[model samples]
Target: MGALTIKNVCKSYGPTDVLKGVNIDIQAGEFLILVGPSGCGKSTLLNMIAGLDGITSGEIQIDGRVVNNLPPKDRDIAMVFQSYALYPNMDIRRNISFGLEIRKVPKSEQDRIVNEVSSMLQIDQLLDRKPSQLSGGQRQRVAMGRALARKPALYLFDEPLSNLDAKLRVDMRTEIKMLHQRLKTTIVYVTHDQIEAMTLADKIAVMKGGIVQQFGSPRQLYDEPANMFVAGFMGSPSMNFIPCKVVSMGNETGVEIDGGAGTFKLPVRSNQLKSSEGQEVMLGIRPEKVTHKIESHLENSDFHLAKCRVSINEPTGPDTNIFIHMNGAKVVCRSTPDSAKDPGEEMEMMFDLSKMVFFDPKTEERLA
Candidate 1:
């Protein structure tokens, strides 16, 4: 089984710390994604896990055994790199079976394994073609087939789809997910794309400045982000962070929002509302919640109506993004293309109070 554990793992090169006290655990068959912006040490962590680099302080455990001293070949793991590291001179069949040949497996067995993996990846027809002759996507499948031929306990994908085109990346993302489901294998993927991390991972570790910002199930990280960076990193169009003052008027405690036309009090559910009263805080809301007024929001007490003057509209086929200014900061609202208001027009929107998340503006930490 491919249960992996990184316990307070720290990596330093001379005086520069690349990974700082990183800790994570995942059971067999779980897909864990390391996601963040560039230079966040995500790829460095992946290399450490693969034994390609040494750990400065802490241990990495694979299947309950410490692997600090184990060589990459001795470890029961396979990796697919971003470059699709295939041999230029070798055909796809040999490229996939080369690992087995290096292990000195019988030629017949190697051929059988290569056939099985190639057929599974839908690359059977390309077996006779050299890696140089194939397209990026095809070469990627050969690389995956090469890894699948090994049947290792764990799989490491270091931005494997990063080199492909946008459409091919999406296609390969689905294929990788399907491959994982069918094999029930453990996977640790590294990527800077939040969309890939959200769609492909069961658990996500958001990294920044050589430290883990947050690590949890995708929903947990999406719904209850640990900090402002996580809130801004995980979702598309990102979460809107409105600078607002927490105010308490009578029994009502909420954040005051200036949505261009006028100011309104919207209730924000938070345990720290009392302590944060009169303090400036960041109110986080996804674009979907601040949509054009809907009938369903009428039954909810947490939903309030507010008018915002549209700055612009970005139509993305299914849903249009309505841009508007709130307290001098631009915020986006998700609405249907047909229902979206024209630019410079005023529109009524339902601001869902229940879904908003509060954060400390100074520290960027969640305020409850």
Candidate 2:
């Protein structure tokens, strides 16, 4: 089994702590992603797992064996680095075969493994070129090929595609996903790009300040973020936050939003409303959830329609972003390109509050 377990892991540089009590259990063949902003200790934790850094406390287990004290080579893992750390003087063939040579694999076996890995990465034609002579993407393929040739139990990737251009990054991301599916090897990938984490990982661990903020599938993180930090971090264009006071209307409780021209009450059914009356809360709604009203969506009890003046319109190919003012804050709504209105025009918009989330303004914690 290629399973991994991190128990109460901690790392420190004298008085400064980098990681604190991190715990994650990864099943065999799972694609796990470590994602967070820089200085959040993601790379530190990954280094500890790879035996490249010392652990101040706790244990790291691989396939049921504790590997905290084991050397990197003995940990039965291969790493692909962000820099595509290939030898500039050596050709791709030599670069890939060098590891097997150090391990004393027979010459014939080394040749066969090199051929297999090169073909697998579709770099067979470039095997004769040196790292300096190849494009960025080609060098990246060679880096992956070297790691694959090892056939190790765990593969660790440290921002492997960070050096590629935007288009190349997208291509490599797809390639990496395909490679993972074909090999079915356990992998631990580190990246700060939320898109990469969502697209490539079977499980994602969002970390901040040495603490794991949330851990789950991409869908869970996107739909039900644990707190404001996670909700804001995971989505593109981001979930909007509108500060408002909880108010009561007859038997229902909700918040009031003023869209420049008028005020509207959006009733919300949440247990937290029992004590949240008159308290400041942040109403969280994703851009896509707020859009041009449709007759079918208006049938839902939780759907709310309001007239708002569009302050700006940005066309993003797939959809147009309409910016409006609500509760004195700028709110973004996603509308079909043809349905979006020009700036300064009044438009009717719908809010799907069934999936809306609430958070405490002071604590930033989610409210049920």
Candidate 3:
């Protein structure tokens, strides 16, 4: 395990700049995830860190050693690829031991390492089989086992769980988490899946358009997102954004919401909104915060009640997605299955204004 540092890293191809001033510091044994949509430079950054791609500028250090010009062999890193990348002609044992063989490790040590890794990953039974003989999940485990055998200073996972089926993905995710916990190794995992980033990483760098939008814990990026993009991209089901005009309500202020039936002001407690009075700002709230009104909601000073006609009701076992309109924009309210009503029915929803976030309409940056 090793500490990793990327300082003012920038990458470009001829005229196109790919990574712009990317900076991330991961302490030893910390799991760091680089996450974003495709073409966001996450994979490119991972490749750069692995020394597979050259650094256009800036520095990358592993264990305080600058590896800007080093080859992959000299980096002391093991990488598990998205495609499994196992040698089809070789058995699982041979595939996992290939690196050890290349490094001229003794046969006894190689066998011991392979055996230990395969056992930990529960792929001991498949060690004699070829890549084609194993299923996708098994192949992924073999790939992880191959990386584990190396015992490198850093482990790089390049969307390693993306190829598995949904159930298998979840299972493998848990397996990987357990592996990290048991080993406490320094890891840099790259995935476009926010769910993976949220569940696995000690720290996350949310990237977009060659820029690091935000770098923090999952909860920090989820609850106190730096901008609208970070707020909208980090959460599952996305945060509901309603454009509302801030207005003065006696001594305090609130944002005006048009909830189909009628317009009402949802009380907002913020000193930041004082300067934003009468201006349009995007109010962001999570679906879970807007749910079926209950007595608990009535007791909170930050909660406000409103009735809206349900446009759609989507059931997902334990919770139902109650779709409604606020300020002419489609909004989703997650409700318990027992209280979920049918479409065309009017339901009272309690808005948890305490958790509401306001963004500047023009800049798309958080205001309050």
**Candidate 3 segments whose C-alpha is farther than 4 A from its true place:** none
lDDT of 2 at 38: 96
How high a TM-score does candidate 2 get?
Answer: 0.97
**TM-scores for candidates 1 onward, in order:** 0.97, 0.97, 0.97
Model 2, 1-368: lDDT tens per residue?
33989999999999999999898998999999999999999999999989999999999998899999999999999999999899888899999999999999999999999999999899999989889989999999999999999999899999999999999999999999999998899999999999999999999999999999998999999989999999999988999999988999888888988877688888886767766789888999999999998788777887889888899999999999999989988899999998899998989999997878999888999995
**Residue range 48-122, candidate 3, lDDT tens digits:** 999999989999999999999999999999999999899999999999999999999999999999999989999
Poorly placed runs, candidate 2 (over 4 Å): none
Q: What is the C-alpha local distance difference test score of each model?
A: 0.91, 0.92, 0.92
Instruction: Give per-model CA RMSD.
Output: 1.3, 1.4, 1.5
**lDDT, candidate 1, 1-368, per-residue tens:** 33999999998899999899999999999999999999999999999889998889998988888999899998888999999999999999899998999999999999899989988999999999988899999999988989899998889999999899999999999999998899999999999999999999999999999999999999999999999999999999999989999998677688898887788888767666876688898889999989998887789888888888899999999999999899878999999988899998888988887789988888999986
Candidate 2 overall lDDT versus native = 0.92
TM-score of 1: 0.97
